[model samples]
Target: MVAAMVKSARKPARRRLSPAEKARIEEIFHRFLSEEDDPRTELNYDSPYTLVVAVALSAQATDVSVNKATARLFEVAHTPQDMLALGEEGLIPYIASIGLYRTKAKNVIAAAKIIMEQHGGEVPLDRAALQALPGVGRKTASVVLNELRIEPAIAVDTHVFRVSHRLKLAFGKTPDQVEAELMAVVPEPYLVRAHHWLILHGRYTCVARRPKCDQCLIADLCPSRGTGARVPAVPEPERHRR
Candidate 1:
């Protein structure tokens, strides 16, 4: 197929994952499991519909801010029908604090209408159908699918992107390339939760400005560990719970 040919033309520039590397990867995840067995998205949503809307609203906003806004928004417009009733103008006031709230309000209303008319008010679980809705991109769909256990996916946000590189789990330049590499190399059992672990790690420990290498449990294995890294400490799990 031409698609296969095109795929092959763009070779995986990163080095192959050898057996030793595979074991190393597993060990890294094992440590993560010891720390936090289950990790969920911080965004508060009761159903698939709310999850989609919440994720779309989360763009250029923190989970805390999204949650703060959605607490009131969801009370009135949690479903496609409810959202349609509220309309774009009605939606803006709820999310005014969030960045790009006006544009997001439009997208949310448009997506809700599409869901109501085309899909009979049910949020599409599949990728293509979800992406067809306004403001619902690949990352949003991936998060929805993975969180619901519909698929094993890694939605590489800024945190995931940085942590992947710092840990040397992936070396790809772009998010898509990094995602492909992570899907290929991350062990199957850990595949689903791997997205959350990396994101949480990057968010709390492997930070951008100056990574808290001293507190990172996987500091010893991280290739990007800064010089003079301290012994890994048992960082309180409660702080990273969100």
Candidate 2:
């Protein structure tokens, strides 16, 4: 038991950024948005209910993977009533490909019941009401709200947390703290789409193991740009070829 406790207390290694590094990160984010189109989530959802369900299933999963599962799931059940009727047992096959399908399906069903019985079969627009639903947290609510074009909110996921720290956008140790810092600092215009931008950047370019730095538009503003980082480098053929 003691050995297990000691092992549990040992935290995984993580990267840290300095003040200069943080400044450079913000600069990169700003510069990237300056020339590019507004950012959006890759997950395809037609309504608020679909967006919330997609986000819930997205924990510790990929957007592409979630999208694949939801593509079929949404077809059969787009609303709370439809989802509740489908039931956890029935919903499993639709989303079974995802990481935690059983639990996600259970939560989705329960939340759907609540939405139908309590909220009159409509997705609530307020954060508090949204949070009261099963498996729905601030990050999930933020995603729904932002997608619905409501108030500006920052949803901190794995990509957001990794990218934010690496770029020094928000240095807090936890996702919640990082989210709060981002909300306080990021300009209003950028807040709603900021989560999407960061998630996409981290997903395709500033990746976890091997970021594609050479193709990154904001590499000039990154402190880790040329630190011999393990990130993937532009292929020699592609470099001059481009």
On TM-score, the candidate that comes out on top is 1
lDDT of 2 by residue, 1-242 (tens): 32332232113233455676556656765776885657777778888889889988887577778999898889999999899889999999998898878998889999999998999999898889998999887677777777675756667676677677666566676666677777655544455567778877877788877778898888776666756443223323211000
Model 2 regions lying over 4 Å from their true place: 1-27, 228-242
Model 1 per-residue lDDT tens digits across residues 144-238: 88787677778877778778877778777667777888877777678778888988897888876789988989888877788533222222320
- Report the lDDT of model 2 for residue 192: 58
Clashes of each: 0, 0
Which residue pairs show backbone clashes in model 1? none
Tell me the TM-score of model 2.
0.80
Provide the TM-score for each candidate, comma-separated.
0.87, 0.80
In angstroms, give how far residue 42 of model 2 lies from its true place: 0.9
Error of 2 at 75 (Å): 1.6
